[model samples]
Target: MSTDPASTDPASTDLVSTDPASTEPAPADRARGFEAKPGAIGSPPQHYGNPLHEQRLLAEGTAVVDLSDRAVLTVTGPDRLSWIDSLTSQAVAKLQPGESAETLLLDPAGRLEYAVRLLDDGVSTWLLLEATEGAALHTWLDRMRFMLRVEVADRSAEFATIGTLGSPSLAPAAPNGIALHWRDPWSAVVTGGHQYSTAQRHPSADWTYSELLIDRAALPEAAALPAAGTLALEALRIAAWRPRRATEVDERTIPHELDWLRSAVHLSKGCYRGQETVAKVHNLGHPPRRLVLLHLDGSEGVLPVHGDIVLAGDKEVGSITSAALHYELGPIALAVVKRSVDPALDLVVTAGDPAIQIAAAQEVIVPPDAGAEANVPRLPRLGAVRR
Candidate 1:
């Protein structure tokens, strides 16, 4: 019943009991009716049969969303922080233990490659990301650790990620002498980051998102608690105007295009792989495209899907990246459209196989004038004499 990118199939491997303390696998594995999220990342339940209710409970901070499928990686050794700081878009060389930071790994052209949620425990730096990004990110990081006193490893098999709208009553597992909880930083602008959204009050102001890492063996118990599905999580994410790397990004995606600078990009950070383009775009040029939230018309009781064409009149301006039926918002979506599209104009989205046109009203996320924050004064025309 849900179309989230995180819902589909059944997990191939059974999350069986591995606790040395108990011989029985936690009953949660069998009782929770868990199914594989889309792309078969890991078997996570889509819902507990009532998505709307689950959304309500999660919003109330009484529910936990199982995110076991997400990939976890660890960087250890003396150079862990500085080594990774030199590779991503955040100034995390001095990230303190227990601090949370979000960063973007961009291609040489400043296009997004990976979005990493980071937490350090003094002994190790943890990288939490989408399931699909684990292998590639691990491979790349491992390759880049040439002469540095650091080491990287894919720790997905050892730990699982559990998401909560806020700190839940149950504490996260402390496997390696540290509570692996990561508080999201998207609610406000970071120290060296910039905000592109001009909203008087950003929806993320109340987004108290946090992720907890637990032993994979403990999944059964965590799943047994008050639980919600990925569907509910995706809906809330769209409403908060939060961007996800797996859904909001494309080949041409720059952090500025998604208002990601507010949390992920450090405008004054030292050189990195894509530093030149990031600097140029923020100082002199506008990103070619921007992100928007679509208040979709749900009159037909239909929700748009990823890749659905978004249009202004007859011209296709962009495509829907993520869409969902929010608990309170009816139907909503996040789309990436040309920065030139007038924010005042209502748009259309065509969904389904035969394609039914759905009217969508735009809620600006990234404005048309999002970049070139340097405030360079405009030079007058040479031929025209000054008055």
Candidate 2:
């Protein structure tokens, strides 16, 4: 807490490497018309051709995304499952092989430290992470391994990640004999998890997103397998109201702010680093902010970028964390706003050097008093005069 985390620690890791070689060759990025994402930690694609069409192809499950910018790590040895369950915000001890789960490691204050996608193939447990977090996470985990039977390894150099719309038809065991793909559990409330979102059905209920683990030697061929860039994946993510550590978490962020409990947190789980803060917030206090999906006015044909200020009239109420042009929904974004901001209010996202503002309509994803247990009391109207 001595140094300012907002500046020193980023919500997601972005690493710029000077190494001449990469898991996937640079020609792969150029072949797909990708422009390097500026200010991003790892070099990922901004887009390839029309992002809208690319999104459509991805939505239809015919496209693959080069996710080398993301990192993969493995934890093995006898105590792997119990060791992870003791430290994270998920109940993972009984996670069967081929099952997938998400977990978060938080600071004592409940601010997220690392968000991991967990999968165990009987022999090893894999953690999918952002490149920006790879080295730091590995170092931190290594330091915390005092007498634990778990062994950690940074597998990013050995394996690359691939994101796809639907589960690939690869056999339970890959032809190469590696059981590597992790099907996202965002499609439903994962076991031992709770949903804070009161929406009748989550927009992401149908999100069949899966991240496949492939060896570095196979990345070039995988990259050439009918590819789309990160832009396509980003658009669909926003449209589905999904939360990602790279885009949504800030220094002050808690799982409640983004309704991440749907897949990432377990309410009654055993103690962890930030259990006190989590329980206190869920039972007595409220998250300071709420997440919302915004339908942006695309008449100007300008889409706002991440970190743009969101204003309600003259006052700044929130900031857009992610924005995109969906294949069907046109321009849309996800923003986290103050809990006090009226859910019915119309907001504008201010963007660009010229300062163009896009009108936005709020779609309530997380309400003002959002919490795991739904027992909100009805307050009597204070100013109502009775006859």
Tell me each candidate's TM-score: 0.89, 0.85
**Candidate 2 local lDDT, 190-210, one digit each (tens):** 766767777897888769899
Q: Candidate 1: which pairs clash?
A: 7-38, 8-38
Give the alpha-carbon lDDT of every model: 0.82, 0.75
Model 1 has an lDDT value of 0.82
TM-score, cand. 2 vs. native: 0.85
lDDT of the structure predicted as candidate 2: 0.75
Error of 1 at 65 (Å): 0.7
For model 1, what is the alpha-carbon lDDT of residue 231?
72
Clashing pairs in 2: 13-132, 13-133, 14-41, 14-132, 15-41
Worst 10 residues of 2 by lDDT: 12-21
